[model samples]
Target: MEIIEKAPAKINLGLDALYKRQDGYHELEMIMASVDLADRLTFELLPKNEIVIETDSSFLPVDRRNHVYQAAELLKDTFQLTQGVKIYIEKRIPVAAGLAGGSSDCAAALRGLNRLWNLGLSLAELAELGSKIGSDVPYCIHGGTAFVTGRGEKIDFLPSMPQCWVVLVKPKMSVSTSSIFGSLSFNSIQHPDIRGLKQAIEADDYLLMTEKIGNALESVTIKRHPVVQQIKDRMMKYGADAALMSGSGPTVFALCEKKTRAQRIYNGLKGFCDEVYIVRTLK
Candidate 1:
């Protein structure tokens, strides 16, 4: 049997790091939502006990280090299953772009394999299992709008965000999430109003949502890569309702109230960015 799953990408509407925890992971509050942009995962049942990955992305490692493979291994060990599976990743989302591409793929594999092997694991169980793989994996397992805290493993589902077009632009450079967090000075940071953003989302007020959009790591990332700042400026100049870098990003996203405006910005940034996408906020 073969199961296919579409794993959507995520964008942080508001992200605030409270402090670096004693465990070395930073304590944070983030309001994140899924976008139409996604990676595709296909699972094929195999007679032998093995995990195989096929992908077009040259950058992604296919070995045990790959998050998708990790997911399979975790599930296999937890369920004590003797069967193996072949995993194929159709990479549409950009790699190492802070878009949670790898995490999403991992989540999708977990979901797909649950059905493929007749392992009756609940979503909560799957999420709990996913947490061991990565901070972002749990949320990716339940893709939608969410209020995430505690290094991103804890999840509180929120109402669907107001509909809007998202114009995403990824620069040629890749960013290291650890490096960005390392440079952060938690003492002097101006935290974003995550509460207000949640309220705006619950009310479905676009303007209020725009006003509350902010990312605490933006300053640190922009300093390292000026192009990130330039992209934000261009998005605002092109009339984006709000613009912010998503996660530890070189990938910047702008929320546009109008589809036409989003298309305009998408075309405008293609010259400067290596990859540009115009997609709707995932429902």
Candidate 2:
């Protein structure tokens, strides 16, 4: 049997670093929402007891390092399933760009394999299983606007965000999320107004949402890649309603209420950056 799933990309609308825990993991509160851009995962049952991963993009790994492979292996080991499957990923999202592309794929795998193998796992159970693979996998299991806390393992779903066109631009460089977090001086960092952002989402106040959008990790990334800040600056200069770096580094997106403004920002970014996409929020 074969099944297909869509692994959508996510962006942090508001991310704050609360404090470093005794276990060395940083306590975080993040506002995240899935975007229209996504990767497609196609699963087909295999005869032997082995997991196989295939992707056309030479940029991706097809082994256990790939989250899709890890997610499949995890399910097999936990459920003691004898069957195997071949997973083909149609890569649309950018890799290592803080888009949680791999984590979303892992979520897709857990969800798809559940139906394929007839595991009968609930969404919460699957999400708990997925959290072991990556922090973002749990959120991707149910893509929408949410308040995520405690290393991104805790999620509180929010109403769908106001409609807006997002122009995403990624430079031709990959970022290390670990290094970005590593370089952070936790003792001294600005925290985003989480309550304000939440209220804005609840009220469907677009202007307030834009005004309150912030990422604590943005400074560290902008320092490493000045082009990231430059992209934001250009977007704001080109009349984007609001612009900010998505997650860690590299990928920056601008929010606009009108398609003309989104297109203008996209066109302006073409020469400045290699990869640019103009897509609307997924409602």
Candidate 3:
């Protein structure tokens, strides 16, 4: 039987980098949520004892370097299974745009393969395995809203964010996450109020949530790509409750409480940017 999974794009409402860790990863606390924009994965059993990955996107690597391939291999080795599978990815999310598209896809692969092989693994189990793949994998495994910490392995499920329309604009350029983080000077970078952001979400206060929205990495990215800030500026000018660069972003998203305002932002940015999307947060 073929198993299908939806891999939604993640948006960070608040992200803070406290310091560089001993492991070379920045100590982080983030409030993350998924949007309706997603990639689809379809899994079918392959007769040969091997893993195969195919995607409609010309830009993605289909081999061992791909996270989905690593996820499948990890599961197979851990479970000692001979059964093989072919995974077809319907690519919808923009790559390297700070959306966690690859991590989400890898999570979907682990979830799908679990069912196709009847591993009977719980999401927690799947997430444990997923953590081995990437920082965002664990959160993607349990998609919704979450307070993530400790280089993204620790996840605290939070209440659903106050409902809003998200208008995303992806600039023509892609960003390297490592380079962005490498450029960070923790001494000077402003830390977002992770605790306050969490409280606002828990209280379901959208206004406070927006007021607290910040990313420690925004200045680092804006130095390299001014388009990110430009988009945020345009978003605010066109009527957005809050605008922030999500993750290590070339993609900036604006949150709006009203659809009409979101549409106006979308309309204004559609002509300026090649990839623009208006989507709601996934409840």
Q: Please report the candidate that would top lDDT against the real structure.
A: 3
lDDT of 3 at 21: 87
The lDDT of model 2 is 0.90
Q: On residues 1-283, what C-alpha lDDT tens digit does candidate 3 reach at each position? A: 8889999999999999988989899889999999999999999999999998999999899999999999999999998999989999999999999999999999999999999998999999999999999999999999899999998989999999999999999999999999999999967899888899999999999999999999999999999999898999999999999999999998999999999999999999999999999999998
- Distance from true position, residue 254, model 1, in Å? 0.4
Model 1: residues with Cα > 4 Å off, grouped in runs = none
C-alpha lDDT (0 to 100) for residue 119 of candidate 3? 91
Off by over 4 Å in 3: none
Where does candidate 3 clash, by residue pair? Answer: none
lDDT per model vs. reference = 0.92, 0.90, 0.95
Q: Give the TM-score (vs. native) of candidate 1.
A: 0.98
Error of model 3, residue 236, in angstroms: 0.4
lDDT digits (tens) for residues 115-159 of candidate 1? 998888898889999989999989999989999999888999999
Report the Cα lDDT for candidate 1.
0.92
